[model samples]
Target: MGSDNSTLSSDVITLNHGVQQYFIPSCEKNRKIKIIATPNPSKGLVNINFENWDDIELSLSVFDALGKLILNTKLNTRNTQLNLSDLSSGIYIISIDNHCGGASSFKLILNSN
Candidate 1:
């Protein structure tokens, strides 16, 4: 629930562009959180790194281009590698949410060959 006075904005940028954006709640504007998913053009295996802030639980979710959720799980560690061998080769979106705070998303690719 955002107020009409909230002028905050969220933008999606390409990974190569070197600019990253996250969805910040109006109340947590002063906090810093970073979510990184590596090996973007990966071969079915990828690693997601949650940087800064730890010892807390978080969630990672994967969705297909059709906006359908494929996988969702809670992460107890700061870093975790996801195996998508069961999924077909395609493009998908991975979203990370620090249940206690912020959230962000990034694109991912899976190649079966």
Candidate 2:
């Protein structure tokens, strides 16, 4: 991703009524941003989150080992949840479509129980 994960400050949050929603910007490559990868060895559930300006839309897609499309989701809300309990044991790629042809990806190693 071109966008630096640094642009995503940990302090920017959105609250409605009494709920607090944290917004993070997508790491765009051309933008020179790096996104952090997590859960190194994730289990049944995995979460892909980003932070940035208040008004940015990002799309996230998941692909499997066979280079097959698995899950495709959009995040205009702030945060989204991805369920990996049903996926097979292997490494998967979560692609975050940021901007200007730049996309950020995270590698997930899942061990099925």
**TM-score top scorer:** 1
Residue 40 displacement (Å), model 2: 2.4
State candidate 1's TM-score: 0.71
Error of 2 at 24 (Å): 11
- The weakest ten consecutive residues by lDDT in model 1 span 18-27
After TM-score superposition, the amount by which residue 50's alpha carbon in candidate 1 deviates from its true location, in angstroms, is 1.7
TM-score per model over all chains:
0.71, 0.62
**Residue 33 miss distance in model 2 (angstroms):** 5.6
Question: Which regions of candidate 2 fall more than 4 Å away from where they truly are?
Answer: 1-34
Candidate 2 C-alpha lDDT tens digits along 1-113 = 57433332344333333222333343443333333434546675765444453335667788998879998877665445678889888998777765545555656788877
The alpha-carbon lDDT assigned to residue 97 of candidate 1 equals 74
lDDT of 1 by residue, 1-113 (tens): 95454234345432433323343222245655555566767888887665554556777899999999999999888678999978988999888777665677777878877
Task: Name the lDDT value of residue 83 in candidate 2.
Answer: 80
Worst 10 residues of 2 by lDDT: 15-24
